[model samples]
Target chain A: MSNLLTYISVNDGKIKRSSLEVLSRCNEIAEKNGKTSSAIVISDDCSTIVENLKSYGPSVIYTIEDPIFKNHLNTPLLKALTLAMSEINPDVMAFASTEGSKDILGALAANRNAAALADVSEFDWTGDAVTAKRPVMASKIISSVETKGSPVILTVRSGSYDTVEKSGESKVQSIPFTFDKNELKLTLKEIISATGDKVDLSEAETVIAAGRGVKDEEGRKLIDELAAVLNAGIGASRALTESGDYDPSLQIGQTGKVVSPQLYIAVGISGAIQHVAGMANSKVIVAINKDPDAPIFEIADYGLVGDLYKILPPFIDELKKIKG
Target chain B: MKFYVCIKQVPDVNAPLQIKEGELIQDANRNILNAYDASAVEEALVLKEAHGGEIEVVLIGPDKASETIRKALAMGADSGSHILTEGSEEFDSFSYAKILAEFFKDKEYQYIFCGKQSQDTDSGLTGSMLAEFLDLPYATNAVGLQLEGENLIVKRQGDTGQEMIELPAPSLVTCSNDMNDPRIPSLKGIMQSKRKPVNTIAVSDLKNGLTNGSIKTSVVGYEEKPKREPGKKYEGEPDEIAKEVAQLLDSAENVI
Candidate 1:
């Protein structure tokens, strides 16, 4: 059919936030194109994984498996996607802009000589083309793109668009495809994991981030207590993380993790542009800096001028009270 | 061993970079190599030095991108080639990489090196995408890379931590800032760069049937980043300030 839309999904390590966002956008686009959207996942088996993602409103789920696919290597995924796109010949192909997906999809688009739009934060279905917003120049500008090629390949920026929720029934099928694992250039011999039990900041919704303002473990404990009360995740600025005061997993800045949280509480962090760009999309922002003029306040919906130590105690006490 | 590294010229990252009145204001006067691309070039240079081989620096972008190539040659690349594209400056990584794949398909370079991702977009897609197009083994965010006969020993970073991977030759590797220290252009190299062979080819030469993407992703407009509020020193005692801070979190700070 001229209007079948395909969603290219990559599942590696933990499923990414961006993948859901892509499926959401595809659903919107497919409606406009007069066809239904389906998910294409490349993995070792379609049994359990495809069933899990079928809830995202795809009419059918296409899968190609190999033991090598378990690592979600980029080149193999690209090859698998290229083969799938040709077979399905969907009018639109979509994916999320996570690390592996970006690379795999971009390269796939290039090799096939197809058009690709990426890091799109928003999109509108027009008469003949889809309008997409890709932020550039350090998030200072937005590029509005209208696609002009067959099966336009697009990668959605993570956390920029809300994932769709299904209240109605959705059709689901499993289609098998040929995945030539031998064609991949790089192979993953081992998967080394991170140490300890710190949380991944990028995946957290409510984040309690501290900067250089916490001078000692005593001050850090207050922030920790506040975090525990709210069941929130903890993050730190570059200064504190580099100072060896906090775990690297807690670092949030340009060179650190990018997070999109529902509520972002900054303690003692003067929002540097590099740092702010990483987390400016938080639903609600709170900045606490002794210096009233800290840059972090520019994007913060709320600002506080006081020492974090004394303020944190009563705040935690009240949160605990609510929890109790 | 032969290495081909991709390089691009970009505006100084912190020169009041802004989108004003629908124009990207890059002080054309001050330009350094793209930070990530520079890392790519640096990684290439390191390979040439350690393994004793030839290094060719390749760049595809606007005409001014030649200046960036000159800087790379001056930094000790054996030579340089330019894949010129009209209005290529406005092209995204998709178009850039497409044009590059066209230029590279015929050449048989043993290894390709690039930054893990360009800093400007932070997309981290170009290198991996390039590997896919070429159907080569690719490793990214590599902090440590060593040559092993026809194989590669690479220390790569992931969401969790570093991984040691072994891949076949003819691979694509992108470096993080940790890979190795990039060398600065020595004075003698700068003087010699003036005479180094710099060749330019029109976009038509590489014409991998690439056109500015049909999708007209245009900019609505841009505004300068808002300046931060100056910190206000609370004169109250530590206890008072702490109380105020807690109150501020729910009210002004909006966190509690």
Candidate 2:
């Protein structure tokens, strides 16, 4: 009964999609165990975020405002997180499987000696513990993890669940927290944030990436035009960037920027391992390559084989017509 | 300065893979150490050659993966350690990190290197996870690294280009192939590797919930891409290519 409370992070009452997914899954657990769920968002800038959190059907939303907790990541956030976890005393503490948030969660989970799952997409609450489906051994295999602990720490992947719908507001409360600053170990001086890029590939709705198959500067012109038409961001394979045909920011692959867009257009890229590592998470992958056997086709939802010399122009034309 | 290069063998990027009977199937192609990790090894060797000391390669995987170990040793690492495990394939990041964390609990190595991500999983989660587990500083995708007193003056490749970050000694770094061409195994080095140390470890030694339940995300299933019709090639006709391209772009692809 006391173990049903769940603490979640929210923004502007607008909870991050992954958080909603975690809450959605956690809600299922609460129902099964006859427990209650309460989510939390710690931020001083929380304007309408509390309203958004209310829509998700949390029994309570811990709204704590502090300049230190304003930023979503880094700054040894575990201090604030640990405080929230301890105060809420939830049966499970959850976070999104993200670079920054997960790092904080990792520390908290270790401190609490709770079972931690990385990048779990599915969840099930059996009698004793929870089971989740996670990619293991470098994404070559899928493994099932069974976790047991009062506060099971879970990090759900982004885009794993449907949008959080309004289940009506049950309760919302502003919880107070002032974590120690000296203990904050990881000091992120700067995020190396991207500016002047106009669009970020990771958050873009549409991405048009070029590969080595781009015949010449001609290919570049076509991609730019397509991006402009679709209002999509421009991305590139290492080959094009390595050849100095495009900016490194346009590069997508291993050691490159990871992107997950609604429409991912990979033009002239062979989809090497390094390149695939970046864009493999895209929802709809469309490949345009000259070689029919190019590896890009392996994960692509739609693949077009032919000389970029022949295919790209037609494809761009088709897109233009659709917009017109 | 003695260097430590952590190398991993992974499936070929272009290898065709499928899931059958709850297992993965892939083409039988010659396995190679990851390009990025290979670059790390090469960078280490250059350090070894420049400032003489042993460069040992460490591999933590199943026995079959020792081939990569031999390859790293052959490629120029002075010696190797293949911590062979019977069922390490089932190990999670925590499990894998625990093994390294427990094994190197007291061992001191000035520099530790790994690839940004393994080609097979491309998770790129381990080294950073290891750094967290070992309580060490970590820098990913370094283009170049130089030792400066008790710290490493390194230029790591970020999401964009090279970034300089200075971290104290005994830090973990993953090299991306942004700079320095990787080296192929030489005949002399390959021959000499036969006499180098290649130790193995039992999988059960570092046991403590080698199993993971950390929720991140999982691949629901393997999907095969559909076939496509090939497009025509453009010769030296720029005007004609542009016009035809423009028409096709307008009709099917949609850019200009």
Candidate whose DockQ is highest:
1
Worst 10 residues of 1 chain B by lDDT: B214-223
TM-score of model 1 vs. true structure? 0.84
Cα misplacement distance, residue A203 of candidate 2 (Å): 2.9
Residues B1-256 of candidate 2: C-alpha lDDT, one tens digit per residue: 5567878777785665676765567764556688778988988888777767778888787878888888888888887877777762456444566677676676778778877667665445566666667776667666677766656766654432344566666778777776578887889878887887888876566554344443323334443322334334433333354445445544565433
Scanning candidate 2 chain A in windows of ten residues, the lowest lDDT window is: A186-195
Candidate 2 CA-lDDT value: 0.64
lDDT of 1 by residue, A1-324 (tens): 554454544434345566777777777767776666777766776566655676676776776666757664665666677777777776667776554554465567766666667666776554356667765555554555566656567777667777785434555444455556566556666666553355545666689999988899898998888777766878888788667687554567655566788788898898876677668777777777788678776677666666777667765775565455
Models 1 onward score TM values of 0.84, 0.74
Q: Can you write out model 2's per-residue Cα lDDT over A75-150, one digit (the tens) per residue? A: 3355566666777777666665544454344445655545566566576664457677764433435555566555
The alpha-carbon deviation from the true structure for residue A221 of candidate 1, after best TM-score superposition, in angstroms, is 5.7
**Quick one: best lDDT, which candidate?**
1
Off by over 4 Å in 1: A1-17, A45-55, A178-181, A195-198, A210-226, A236-251, A254-256, A288-293, A304-322, B17-21, B85-90, B122-125, B160-163, B178-192, B208-256
Error of 2 at A301 (Å): 6.4
